[model samples]
Target: MPTTRLSKVFPEELSEDTIHIIVQRPPRDLEFMPKNKRIRITEGWKPYKASNGKSVDLPPSWIGFLESAELEPDPRKAFDYLKNDLQAGDAINIPSMGQVPKDFGIHDQNHKVFVTEQMLELWEDMRGDKD
Candidate 1:
């Protein structure tokens, strides 16, 4: 199940949809924000030369998506949606402890995700280690 955190909203100062997040560094997150294909983070972290100076582009919006993924309101219904709606590399991201791959069963991949081409593309698109 996923969780969402809320911050103080200064409605008078900004638009309702605008979110603000500040942190010392990005957390170890692929575990929380998996590279799913249906939704996307159009803008990712990158180096940019701005009018002020050079800086990095970082967005914490994935946190919203995480809470929405609680597997948030109803895990049972969310699981159902994944089972029925996922296709074309889409997957159900449940914590499958002691789960084994079919046929091989050679190794237990409790924390593995089904990697697809789309997932790969999404990974490259996101802000990565290199500039």
Candidate 2:
């Protein structure tokens, strides 16, 4: 069976000033945890600039949360508040994230999180009775 993969298609070349990336907290189900997680890229939603001169897609108030990265003495802890106290169904933002390589075919330079059969079963367990 072919493996599933994911990647981002950036609209333009990203620079440090233009975007803030956050590793998202994984969705939870019972006691099981997801092996992989995702990152949320905030580009101010692009083209629409808020008064603070940054773009906004999340809460307009969250712009401050994104910028709070600067307050963290330990760079890794940037956006710490969003991720620090999370419960099931709670999505939080993290400062740094990493990527894995592709599973098959040609080597995709882009990171690929190999979705295993076990992962699928976990999803089914989590989705139980939900619409």
What TM-score would every model get versus the actual structure? 0.17, 0.19
**Candidate 2 per-residue lDDT over residues 46-82, each given as its tens digit:** 3335668876466434556555654434355654454
Count of residue pairs whose backbone atoms collide, per candidate = 2, 1
CA deviation > 4 Å runs, candidate 2: 1-109
Candidate 1 local lDDT, 35-109, one digit each (tens): 652134544544444446756454435434433443334335444433243345554455433323465323563
Residue 124 error, candidate 2, Å:
0.6
Error of 1 at 29 (Å): 41
lDDT of every model, 2 decimals: 0.46, 0.44
Task: Give candidate 1 misplaced runs (Cα > 4 Å).
Answer: 1-109, 128-131
- Model 1 residue 108 CA deviation in Å: 6.1
- What's the distance in Å from true for residue 129, model 2? 1.6
lDDT at position 81, candidate 2:
58
